[model samples]
Target: MNYQPSQNDIVNEYIENLSAEIAPLFLEIRACILEAGPEFNESIKWKNCLVYGTTKNHIQTVVGKGKISLIFHDGVAIEDAYGLLEGDGKKARTVRITSPDFNRAALQDYVRQILQRS
Candidate 1:
């Protein structure tokens, strides 16, 4: 991933308002995603979700009460060798993160796969 893009202001504001419990986890996840796929552009979608993509939306970050869910829009196509992705939707799958110790390697693999397809 070579086309690195800057973070969006609206997305930054959203991160700023996150609760203490979830903010750190969210930031860790965001950093991992950006590092894995630097070509992705960050943006807010559907009012609350922080979406990352190059030409189209790929991953959507949804902050929940005690966890952060990464929704891969083209998830059905990603090879889940780590068995981290969850969901049975037609296209999307999710990786729910509840702690700071979430598997960074698996997450980066997923991001790289998405980058390749995109």
Candidate 2:
């Protein structure tokens, strides 16, 4: 697979294709983050999707050329506060995977807490 990404760019055109399968889910996820607080900002970062909190970025999609990666950033660094969210990154402090499966409530809880703490 060949990919050409400009410096500091994460959302390539490839990621836009995921909107068909991931946008609906992404909307739900965004809602969850918004419900957490008013500080979180939903914007396109790295040309991909990103949810920004005041102190730090809360969530950002890692969807790449042929794979998707959703990182929880500092939120996942919290000890077992990810609302029983399941994924390859379950064990790691932060989540790094290429799947659309996510625990909406758990993810919401995570955003809420991180925004509160940060």
Candidate 3:
């Protein structure tokens, strides 16, 4: 993809550029992140979505052609009681959302946990 992002780039532009199937779910995932806390800051970086906590970025969303990937920065340390997070990376884990009906509570819990740790 020839994505040349600028300083004025926004999350809306990223979402708008995605396919119809992925855009709505992407927005829902972003909504879940925002619901976690009022202190969570949002920014568009590397043509992806990022939600930052008070200290560091809690999660980064990669909107693909079919699915939206929520990559948790410190996912290896998190306790996934519900077993929703995927990937087996040393430090990060990914939660791929193909539908709009993802686990918002889990996402919020993750954000809160990460923020507390930070």
Candidate 4:
């Protein structure tokens, strides 16, 4: 798929090296986030994590053994109507994806809300 022009090469490498077990789910989540907010750019942060944003970081992707965690940087401000967001940190919330059939609608909603806020 044609992604945004701002896509970073380093982030591309990171996604390319993802384990077979989580790559599909990670790609799906990446597609969902990009589709929901086409203006966002991708980059690798903290040496390993993939982060998405416009001018500043908004969402962070953390890969785990068998799951992927999407961390909304300003998640505290986004509406959680679907109750999919987790965490009680000062400003971040996470959505854990473990399977291919994750909640796309809710994920898209969160992405849109973050875009609107930005």
Candidate 5:
């Protein structure tokens, strides 16, 4: 039989190997999502920070040169009363954090809202 690693395992390894500066931000965003509820799961699929729960491919993260991107796969279905979400795609949206001092409370709130929509 062939052996293949699970997505969770891949993501864990990715996180473990992240650069010093990017790792904390990655962790912080992860923690924010996890705190929303116990329904979410994550993995490193498509070489991006992929999250699942409520729906497959529900969320994803991209670590760019100097920014981190939080992507909502079905963002069109969620409420963004604060107008924080960016993107105009038919089905997706994104929020970007450019610095280490990004707002935690707001992020948590956004995560909570997204998770609750599940």
Candidate 6:
């Protein structure tokens, strides 16, 4: 199997150039996502920060413009647990991720679920 840089170069560049106003949150979010695994991937997709799983996990988390989000590429797998998920698609759900209003246990559970699905 092959592996890729977790943050690609863009995510690193973004983090490097983020304004002080949002840099801390970006750092926090980056730290949170790093919980995935040393082998997990980090990259840019659709201009968003993407953390790709090393295995068969169905998630791709991104910190976008005004808010951060976790993309449940397999929505049905976690919809019942993350009641806040919105969208009517067979394969995706958007999850808002603001640390101040975030649920750590639930987020951990979500990450755990993604890990288990593989």
List model 1 lDDT by residue over 66-101, tens digit each.
999999999999999999899998999999999999
lDDT of each prediction vs. the true structure? Answer: 0.87, 0.52, 0.72, 0.87, 0.70, 0.61
Task: Quote model 3's TM-score.
Answer: 0.80
lDDT order, best first, reads 1, 4, 3, 5, 6, 2
Model 6 scores a TM of 0.70
Per residue, candidate 5 scores C-alpha lDDT tens digits across 1-118 of: 1122235777667776777777777676676667764567766677565565656667788887767898887787777776778999998888898766777776666677667666
Over 7-111, each residue of candidate 3 has an lDDT whose tens digit, in order, gives 345754765577766656766776677678657766776546655545677788776778878888888888897798888779888888887878888888887
The TM-score that candidate 1 achieves is 0.92
Best by lDDT: 1
* Total clashing pairs for each candidate: 0, 6, 0, 0, 0, 2
TM-scores of the candidates in the order shown: 0.92, 0.56, 0.80, 0.92, 0.78, 0.70
Q: Which digits, one per residue and each the tens of the lDDT, describe model 6 over residues 1-118?
A: 1122234677576566666665566565555556644455666566555556665545666655666777877765773565767778987776787655566566666666666665
Question: Which stretch of 10 consecutive residues in model 4 shows the poorest summed lDDT?
Answer: 1-10
Better of 2 and 5 by TM-score: 5
Between candidates 2 and 3, which one is better according to TM-score? 3
At residue 33, candidate 2 shows an lDDT of 55
Off by over 4 Å in 3: 1-9, 47-53
- lDDT (Cα, tens digit) per residue for candidate 4, span 38-96: 88888888869988999889999999999989999999999999998999999999999
The positional error of residue 61 in candidate 5, measured at the CA in angstroms, is 0.7
- Residue 9 error for model 1, in Å? 1.4
**Residue pairs that clash (backbone atoms under 3 angstroms), model 3:** none
